[model samples]
Target chain A: MSELLKIENLHVSVGDKELLHGINLTVEKGKVHVIMGVNGAGKSTLMHAIMGNPAYKITKGRILFEGQDITELSVDKRAKLGIFLSFQSPVAVAGITMENFIRTTKTTVSGQQQKVFAFKKLLKERMNNLSMDASYAERYLNDGFSGGERKKSEILQLRLLEPKLALLDETDSGLDVDAVRIVSKNISEYHNENNSILLITHLNQILQLIKPDVVHILIDGQIVREGGAELADEVEQNGFDAYRLAVKGDGNDEA
Target chain B: MKEIAINRLPVLTYRYLKTNDTKILFSAPQVSAAADFSDKTYVTVGAEFPENFEGASSETLAAALAGEKYTITIPSGMQAKLTIEIKLENQHADYAGAYHFLLQKGAKLELVWKLSGTEAAQGSYLASYYELEDAAELKISKLQADLAEATLYDQRFFKLGKAAKADVASAELGGKQVIVHSRGALNGDEAALTERTVYTGTGKQHLDLFYHIDHWGKKTVSLIDGKGALAGEAKKIFRSTLDFHRGCAGSEGEEGDYAIQLSPKAKNISLPLLLCTEDNVAGNHASSAGQVSEEDVYYLMSRGFSWEEARRIIVESLMRPIVDSLETSLQEETLEEIRRKLDAKGE
Candidate 1:
């Protein structure tokens, strides 16, 4: 396997406050990596920093995609370069239909205009696979959508964009058991030999459905432990209290 | 040439802001002629103006400049559709016209007005008056697509009787300077009126829009909704008012203006007012003028769209509802004009 993404000693900040301390991680192609952490452990910040969200500024270190430095690329440029982020809370945009929005995005990424009929057929098929209502195609993008539906919509985009690296920021947070199953199935289907996934989650429901190649216990913006898929089960059983106490002990010693 | 103030606000404001009224240079054009239309039995090409006809700008100098009038009368219990095309020729020319529509009891009419110009620098003044009797219905659609160097003055007035209803949709997509004034009177019980206007401004375009609706009958209802986008150095001022009279008990009125500014130098001013004298009446008003949300832009950008492409999509989406409401041909024409103004290619 070859490395698909590499983050070396990354430091991120929002406004005047530093959020993500120096962090290092790497994901190989055809691999699924899971990050388990408590609330405020800089999980979302790391995801956003990787996706080039302007709100999260990188003060130190570099991000290498396939060994090319992408630390300064804008969000759109990064997206074009095959980086995708499944937002925990997607913004609702009125006026543009779901079909139109997706079609335009596909055209932009693929550098080709999509035929209306063929694109509609593909969209309908994909929507059917997700168990989404056919009428959602004509509805405004994410407007008035329920929580589960929004999650499904995010997964739908994940399946359509097919980026090389998908950074999911707690995508399974607000879903029911059934919804989680559907989403996990879609995510599993989207992952192939040529793609990678870096998912952040607090629940084990999704982990049970799609096994992770590597699980990293993130405590205080740093990956404190890394192991096989059993690491996730260990965290689920023991929780982040042990890791939090260990970090506190180290801090007390430094002070 | 002379100067006259038109589209004056019903209530006075600070004198320095100049939002109280608009002043324009006016001179009657020598090339006055009837508009092109397919003549029907109920339509009169060169009809005499009704004695009691009153326009929204009747109190202004616009009433004095009206010329070349036409009238259409829909008989009782009848349905009719009419289309009128007005074209202006010659640069630096001026043209003015008036249209009168009367729908008798239980009559229904669908009216569409198209305005265009061949010359780059011209002026046009149009006044449209509608009077619907008891239980009559009217649907009016107007599309204005003149040259960028032209100036247009559009005024409309409505008088709806008992149980009558009127719905108006206007798209202003052209002209360097456009001024619109509209007024409606609900004088009978259960009468309703809805006016929706959408516009787009680019370059150095200037748009002054005003709408006033009065509820004077029991259980009357009125809604004035305006939506538009401004790009480049465009400036737009929107003023809307809804008044509920003392005798108009159980009346409801709502007015709102929503604007999107697409450029740093663009300016948008919106003022929505509601006045009610009846204690039992319900009145509401809202106005919003701001640039597109940064989060929305970021959301679109994250989907592989460049910043410019994302902004264009958002702006087009904002104006899509009203644009889609137009007839098929008019919809295409309006969209083309919008694309040209935005400097974007067709999708």
Candidate 2:
């Protein structure tokens, strides 16, 4: 398989402290690589760094997307390049409805104005598949959505955008059983033969559905282990206690 | 000018900005006088205005100078929608006028007032009055914009009968200097009144809003929700008073002022006062001014919007509550005006 995204020794910082200390990873085309980590493991830092969040400063290393360097591109430029990040907590934008936001973003990324009628039809179908209320299209973007609804909204974006590479940063983090099932289904639906996905989650419920092609245990900004799909099942059956005890002595930076 | 005496609140007056030698427009676009009132009662100016509400200098000056007076009365059980577009066509000319509307028992009236100033330097003064009979309903939606290098004096008075309801709202988008005064009396039992306002000040502008609502009847309900944003060296002052009389037992009154201070040099003053002569009433007032959130801008930027558009979204949210009260046909236009003002790089 060909490499869809490659990161070489990416060091990221917030303010004075560094979060990701010499991290390296890669995602291959048509593959779902899950990053299983405990809290404060720099999982989100890596995802945000990829999405070009200004808050996450990239101090060193390079990120190549589709054989092109995108380390210095703006967030919107990255989005235009089909790089999408599903935020753990989507910001609420009042007055701008969810439908407007989605359609405007799609237009910007596609470099064309999406027809309203056609967009509505597509949005309606996607909302129906997620069992979301049609009225939510007219409501403010995640203004007062519940936890499950917010997760569903992220999935809705993923399914609609169908980006080349998606960074699903805990898209299933705060979901109940039913919500988890729905989110997992949507996540699985977004993946295909032509695209790649990097799923960041500590929950095995989603892993049970997507059947990751590869799994990596990220401990303190470093990938401690990498294995096939079976690695996720092992970690699910037994928590990452071995890696936890080992990282205690590694002296990795606290996330 | 005989004397500019009434409405002389020390803080709201702009003594430095002098008006022209109070000249009356002998004739205005008579289209306002001959509105088709069959369907809406087609509410427009007819001929019924009192000489004064204790005439403020602006009112008296308008009456004496560019006086254009109109009055209209709707019979009982009649429904009317009054959509008035006040376009100051003179450019550099001054305008002054007065209007009064009376709704009989069970009558309903909805008024949408649009006021826009042209490219020339102009000044205007307008006074409007409304009387709603028992069980009558009245709604007022006013949109004012593009008044740069202009001055405006807008005053509204209302008298409600028993169980009558009134919803009055206005959106102030652009103006060099704008003064707004509103007073109403709920003289009947169970009368309800709600006032919604949105204002913005940029450049070296001055915007003043003064409102007083008195509950003279028992169990009356009154609310004043005023929201505004100031940028540049502009200044805004909001004075709102909700009064409950001794006989008005079981009444509820609330006043809230929310301001977005975009520039550190911009000044925002809020005076929310409540006078209750009755002990059995519930009263509350809140005033707050805060800076626009940079985090909000970053979040929107991540969504592909520019910094200008991101600030527009936030200001739109702040004004959405009042904008929603505008007529369906006017909502989009008013929003566009707000967006354009914010795009001018005013916080």
Candidate 3:
């Protein structure tokens, strides 16, 4: 497999506080990478940094997408280059309907004007797959959606945009059993030999459906351990306490 | 040319702020043309103005400058649909017209009005009055999209009788300087009035809008909603009042003004007022003005829209409710004008 994304000693900060400490990771084409951590372990910080979120400043290190440095690119520019981040908490933007928003975004990213009728038909089909009601197409984007519905809406964008690299931040956090199954199935279908996915989650429930090729244990803004899928099972069986202690022990030794 | 003070607030404020009233240099136009109506059966060429016709603006000035008048009377228990178009053709042209509508008891009317003009047309003054008897209903969709160089002065009055109701949706999208004065009086028990206005101002355009609704009978209801956006060096002042007079027990009134400022230099001033003279009445007023949300912009940008495109989309969204309320043809035309003004720079 070829490398799709490579982060070299990435250091990220928010305001005056550094959230990511010299992190290094790589995602290969056709592979699913998972980062599991407790809350405040900087999982979201890493994903945002990869997507060029201005709020997450990269104080040091560089991010390369398909070997092209994107450390200085704006969010829109990075998006145009086929990097997508499904927000943990999507904002509700009233006035623009879901159909119009998706069509506009797709047109901008695909560099083509979409026909209204064709786009509507395509949107309807995709929405049906997600079990979203047809009326949601005309409703304002996530204006009054329930939590599970919002997650499905995010995945709908993920399937439609079809970006080369997708960073989903806890897409399965708030879903129930059935919704989780459906969302996982859709995500599994979206992944193929030509693309990659980097998923961030604290729960192992989602892992039961979509297996991760690699799992990294993150603690105190650093990766404490890296292994195959069994690492997630081990963490689920025990907890992150052992990983947190190991990082703390390492810090004590350094001190 | 003469000078007159118009659009005075019902309650006085500090005089230096200029929110109390506006003074404009006015000249009566040479052209006098009647509005084009879709159906002529219920229309008459000339009609006597109502004895108690009161507008938000100076009623005397509106009466003195009026050049043409058309009246439409809907029969009792009947339903009617009407489309009226007022177009000014000449450069530097001026026009003033009066329109009167009478709906008998249990009558219903759906009216759509379109006002347009040439690129360099000077001024247009329109005064419209509606009188609805017991249990009558009226629905109005008004679109004002004249050229950017023109000036517009619109005055509307509504007198609703027992159990009557009126719904008005107005879209003001053009003109160098636009002034709107709308007033409604609910004189009968259970009468209701709902007026929603949406506007967009670009370049150096100025918009002065005032709306006042009086609840005089028991259980009367009134709602006034104003939403708009401002760009460039444009400025807008929105004043709305909901007054619940004595003997209007169980009446409820609500008014709100929400605005989005698109440019740094754009100005938005909103004043929402509620007055109650009866102890059993309910009234609420709210006003809010702010810039576009940074988070919303960032979210749109993540979808590959530039900063400018993101702002435009958000503004369009804010204006969508009113734009969608227009007729299909007018909807497209109004959207085109919005896009043009948004794309233009330093106009």
Identify the candidate with maximal DockQ. Answer: 3
Writing each residue's lDDT as its tens digit, candidate 2 over B153-246 gives: 7778888899999998888876676777788799999999999998888878887777788989999999999987888898877778889889
The positional error of residue B59 in candidate 1, measured at the CA in angstroms, is 7.2
Fnat, 2 decimals, each candidate: 0.63, 0.33, 0.71
DockQ of predictions, in order shown: 0.68, 0.33, 0.69
Candidate that scores best on lDDT: 3
Taken over the whole model, the C-alpha lDDT of each candidate is 0.83, 0.79, 0.85
Q: For each candidate, what is chain B's TM-score?
A: 0.92, 0.85, 0.94
Q: Can you give the lDDT of residue A197 in candidate 1?
A: 96
What TM-score does chain A of each model score against the native chain A?
Answer: 0.96, 0.95, 0.96
lDDT of 3 by residue, B167-208 (tens): 998888878888888889999999999898888888889898
Cα error of candidate 2 at position B21, Å: 25
What is candidate 3's lDDT per residue for A1-255, written digit by digit as tens?
898999999999999999999999999999999999999999999988998878889999999999999999888988899999898888877778888899889999989899999988888888888888999998999989988888999999988889999999999988998888889888998999999999998788789888899998888899888889999999888888878878878433221
Q: What TM-score does candidate 2 get on C-alpha atoms?
A: 0.86
Task: List candidate 2 segments past 4 Å from native.
Answer: A250-255, B1-66, B216-219, B244-254, B273-284, B345-347
Give the C-alpha lDDT of model 2. 0.79
Better of 1 and 3 by DockQ: 3
Candidate 1, B83: how far from true, in Å?
A: 2.1
